[model samples]
Target: MKKLVLLLIVLVFACKNETKIIEKPIEAVKAKAKPTTKFILETLKSKGFKTFDYVDTKTKDTVIMQQYFIAFLKSGPIRNQNEEESTLLQEQHLAHLGKMYDLGYADISGPFGDDGDIRGITIYNVPTLKMADSLANSDPMVKSGRLQIEVHPWWAAKGFSLR
Candidate 1:
C-alpha cells in the first residue's frame, strides 16, 4: 500500500438564502481519488467491515448518490448482549477491514442525535456501484445482529477533505 497525505482546507463561502444545482463530470477527475477521502476509507475499514465499495470516479456513484438510506440494524437483548464479547467481535472486524483496505477513517461532525437511538453515517471505498449496493446487504454487523447499518448516499460536503 502507498502512503497518501490528505490536505484539507476548510473554506467558508458566504451564501445568501437561496438554492442552486451544480454538476461535476466524473471523467474530469476519475483517474485519482482525493487524498483525504482515500485516507478516511482506509482507516475506517481498519475498525471493521463486512463489505466495501471502491467508488469509480468515472461512474459518479457514491453514498451521496442516494438521499440517505434508513436501515434498521439491531440493538436488542439477544443481539450483542455482552459488551465484552461485542468488543472482541468489533476488534476482529476492524482487523479484517484494515487488512482489506489501505487506511480507513470517518468523521462525525454535526449536532445530531438519534433521540436515544444509536445511529451514525459510515463511508467506505468501493470499486463500483454494485459493490456499494452489496455492502449493506451483507455487512458483518447486520449478519451478527449487532449493528444495523444503512447507506445514505447524501454525504455532507463539509467533511469532504477532513484531516
Candidate 2:
C-alpha cells in the first residue's frame, strides 16, 4: 500500500505542467455563448412593470412572479362526494381560478389534494398581490367556505415560459 501510494503521487506530479502548455486539443474548445435574457423582458412588460437592462435596450424582466397562495377545504358536502362529483368539483375549481383573470391574476394551478376532503391551494403571479388577495377573498371557493387565500411574494429566478 505504501509503494502504491508513492507511485500514484509521482504519476500525478509528472502529469501536471507548472507552465502554460499548448496541447493538441487546446483549439478544440471555443468560448461558450452567454445565456440570453430575452424572455425576462417580455414577462416584465406583460406584468406592467417597465424594465431596462444594461446589456440590451430591449430585454424584459421575466423573473418577476406575481404569486398567491390559495387554500381549499375538503370536508362538508364534498366529504363524501362520488366520482362524478369529484370530477365536477375539479373542473369547477380550475374554472373558478380562470375566472379570476377578470380580477387580474396569472399563472395558476391546483385545487389539488391528497387526503380527507382534498383541499387545493395554488400560487399565482399577478401584477399586484392585492388583486390576487381580493380575488381570493371574493372567490367562490372562499365564499363557499371551502377555500382560503394568502398573498405572498414570489419570483422566477431565471427563464420564463408556460410549461
Candidate 3:
C-alpha cells in the first residue's frame, strides 16, 4: 500500500513538472514575438524603403515616416482626340492605375472634381522618384498626350489610412 501511494505521488509530481516545462517554452515564445509596429518597420526596412522614426510629443507614440512619390496628372498638350478615342484612353488609364494598386505600387489615385490644369493625383508607394515617374508615364492617357505626369518626392507616415 505504501508503494502504491509513493507511485501516485511520483506520477503527480512528474505531471506537474511536465506542465511547467511546457508552459515555460510558451512564455518564452510570447516574449520573443515582435509587436506589430516593429514587424512593420522591419518589413519596410527589408524592402529597402527609406524610413525614419519620430515620437509624437503629445501622445509620446513612435511614428514611422516613409518616403513616397506623388505624381500629379496634368492636362497634356494634345487633347484633340474624338469622343471614342478619348473614352478608350480613359478606360485604359483607369486600368493602368488599378494595376498599379494591385501590384502594390500605387496606394491611392483619384481625379479632381474641378476643371483645372491639375486633373488628378496618384500617390505611389515606390521608394524612388524615377520608378514612380516610369509608372505614371506608362498610363495610356499620358502616352496618348491626353495627360502629363509631374512626379515629386513626398513623405508621409507609414501604416496610415485616409479618413
Please estimate how well model 3 matches the true structure, expressed as its whole-model Cα lDDT.
Answer: 0.94
Task: After superposing candidate 1 on the true structure, give the runs of residues whose Cα lies further than 4 Å from its correct spot.
Answer: 1-80, 96-100, 103-115, 127-129, 136-138, 155-160
lDDT, candidates in the order shown: 0.43, 0.54, 0.94
Off by over 4 Å in 3: 1-39
Q: Provide the lDDT at 146 for model 2.
A: 49
What would the per-residue lDDT of candidate 2 be over residues 101-135, giving only the tens digit for each residue?
Answer: 54445555564546645565555555565665766
Q: Which residue runs of candidate 2 sit more than 4 Å off their true CA positions?
A: 1-91, 101-104, 116-118, 158-163
**Whole-model lDDT for model 1 versus the true structure?**
0.43
Better of 2 and 3 by TM-score: 3
Q: Output the number of the TM-score-best candidate.
A: 3
How many clashes would you count in candidate 1? 22
Please report how far candidate 3 places residue 77 from its true position, in Å: 0.9
Task: Rate residue 138 of model 2 by lDDT.
Answer: 62
Per-candidate TM equals 0.37, 0.43, 0.80
Q: Lowest-lDDT window of 10 residues in candidate 3?
A: 34-43
